[model samples]
Target: MTNAIQKLYPSTKMSIVLAVILFTLMMPGYISQYSVFPIFIIIAFISGVGTKFLSAFIKSIFVLVLFIFVFQCFLIPSDTVIWSKGILTLYKEGLEASLLMTSKIIAISSSLIWFFLVTPIKDMMFALEKAGFSKKFTFVIYSTIQLIPQMKKLSQTILEAQKSRGIETEGSLMIRLKAFLPMLGPLVLSSIQQTEEKVLALEARAFSATVRKSSYYQMSKKPVDYLVISVIFIGFMIFVWWRFFK
Candidate 1:
């Protein structure tokens, strides 16, 4: 099956993303924990991002979530003890607190991941530019987005070079830890050098010159874009009402 969500206009998708963020922020922790995740899980499954979501969750958010869970379980005291061993005690209250935080983080991160996974950077830049956003600000965001992959590739190259030089990256934990320092210096120096070069290039191109800019690509909003935007607005309003008036 095709991923229909990926086919939506960038503006429409961005509106939906903003709405999700607003909704997550407005709702209480308990409600967000109970509500936000299941909704996104379904959307992710339908959009064929379930595998990506799982991979992202594992690699990025999982560590933070685990840390919160462990921290709360140990430090927070409650009357209701779910588990206890010698010096360790797990409380129902701490579990609830951890779940609340985990859900909020997951909701926000998942929305952002969904946005980047489906929308091309050019399309995003085009949409923002059309919406009268600042070119300089957008350039920073766009540059950072492009820079991430370059840095990742650079790191991998540095690692391979070290391995080739008989730097034991594998073995005991201490050996790997010792290998890390050598990897760090080259990576940091190379990044700083590249950044300086980019700054010079941008200056040469008059990136800071105050003039209206034009995009080579054009983006036209479809009827579905309006419809999706309307739905998102209504959802935001409903959330506001429920959060404040209800």
Candidate 2:
């Protein structure tokens, strides 16, 4: 059974995420942008996917944000030097820019990550189809979203198979690198084979037939969805006024 938040319409969840992205873009200062990150964590916990959400965030976006911060601090040129040690120098301007950029990245990425974590991909595609999206468009969206998780799963399976075969996958960095290199060949070939199989399966199912498709699953927006969307809109407008007019 899904929780209340997870049970909400995909469109509703998408709108909430879009609002977060918009706010991150429009809001000034590091504090506001960084504030959105924790809000996503709170939402993830409320939705009962906090552990998965944090694991994914740490493995992906956290590393990317950290890299951007480090690169900007060291590489970007500026007259105002904040810190220096030996050949390394940190610029005040670069640090400020990095904070702003990384904060936006975190807010935007976390919102999206939270949405996908809470909402299943199949349900999202179904909702898009209900919202008048073409099947082809929805299929592309579904495929793109599923690609990463699918690849990750496949890689893990292959790694385990290698380990079972007495391959040295868990050792020094060089040993792991060697193990990983062999896995790449199999991974790529397996991915291609899976794609062909999927294509054949789609054809067998008349996926491209010029006929209408019907689904048994029905989804509709509830009153609470409207209430939540309204709250988000009101919050957005208030932020806009405060950001620009005030």
Candidate 3:
């Protein structure tokens, strides 16, 4: 039951993500800050992406989030000091600013991970195509998303080769810097070569020809998908009214 519900329509998933982002952006302070987590947890559990979403979110944004908090605490000067020690001081307003920024970042990041976890690349492309996006544009978008992992793998391969050659990376900063020089060369070259090959392959398949591309993939929305989408839409409206008109 859970697994089935998790497999929602790509459009439905996209709607929820956009709605959450919109709400987070419009509502300031604690409302936006606190609302995201509960919403994310609920979506994650229902969609069976709890572990994956959490792991990805933390790994990707943990450093940035920490930096924001620390930077704001020390750098942003305020009259009302929350904590003080000689030259160091933490301001109340600065801390509040840090918390708000961190919350927005986390909410946006988690929502993105949730979208990718639940929607396959092919399905996303198909959905975009159905929504009147050009096939070539969708292909480019998909390839760009895929490029990150490919580059990571390439970097790992380069590091392994360096390790085999006795280039110490886990030693002093200078040694690691030396190792990075060799790794950087091959990684960039290989990425460029891969891009060229992909371009050639696409050209060979008449990708640039003025012809309609036939898609084998199809996506359909169920009643649940509709219900979820409608709810998200209503939520967005209510948020706007409360934030502005009301």
Candidate 4:
């Protein structure tokens, strides 16, 4: 059976993540915001995408978060010094600011990353189309979302082709650099060539036809999906009231 989260409509998943992000942004104190990260990890595990989610998080956002933390701690102006050396010093206010900023960053990034990890792009596009988005608009959204993965796949194929031809892709750092340099030209040319071919294919298939298109894949928001979204919305409103009015 498919994972429960993977079965939910894309919009439902999106609403859940968006709620978490808004919560992280509005909630004061480092403990509250930072706590969202682990909660995301737990949700990822339950959703059966723990490994992929964590891998993407570590590869993409971990270093940036660390850099921001260190940078803010040392560079941001503050009156209270927490630690100091001749030329390097840490400020109390800076540390506090860094913690807050880093927590929000982690929370927001993890939410986005988790959402994408669990929701397929094809499903998202289908949902958008079903929601009355024009073909061209949905295609633009689809292409933008698929760009990075497509580029990575194309580059890997080119690298493999080079390797088959005895290119020295694996060696000392400089040798690998040399190998990568040769692939850049082919990669760019191939990408442009593919784009042209894709355009022609789309034209032949009447991609811009006025008739409504049908997709083989079908998705709908079930009762559980609506229930989850409602709960999230109510909780969000409650939090907003508690934060602002109460």
Query: What digit string (tens of lDDT, one per residue) describes model 2 on residues 1-246?
Result: 369999998988999988988888877788988988898899899999999999999998988988988888998888999999998999998899999999998899999889988887778888878877888898888788769898889889888899899899778999988898778889998778888889989989999898766778877899999999999899889988988898
Q: State which candidate, 1 or 2, has the greater TM-score.
A: 2
**Error in Å for residue 16 of model 1:** 2.0
Instruction: State the C-alpha lDDT per candidate.
Output: 0.82, 0.88, 0.83, 0.89
lDDT winner between candidates 2 and 3: 2
Q: Which lDDT tens digits does candidate 4 get at residues 75-171?
A: 8778999889987999898888889888988999889999988898888899899989888898888888779898888888888899999999788
Score every model by TM-score: 0.75, 0.78, 0.80, 0.84
- Candidate 4 clashing pairs, residues 3+ apart or interchain: none
- On lDDT, who's better, 1 or 3? 3
Candidate 1 residue lDDT tens string, 1-246: 246677777888888778877777777765754476667667777777878866776798879988999988778898899989999999998998888777778788888777777777888888888889999878989989988898899889999999999999999999999999999898898788888998989889988788888877886888888888988898788878878998
Steric clash pairs (candidate 1): none
Clashes of 2: 0
| Consecutive 10-residue window with the lowest summed lDDT within model 3 | 1-10
Q: Where in model 2 is the C-alpha error above 4 Å? A: 140-209
lDDT of 3 by residue, 87-182 (tens): 889988889998888888888888888888888888788888888889879988998898889788878988898899998989888888888889
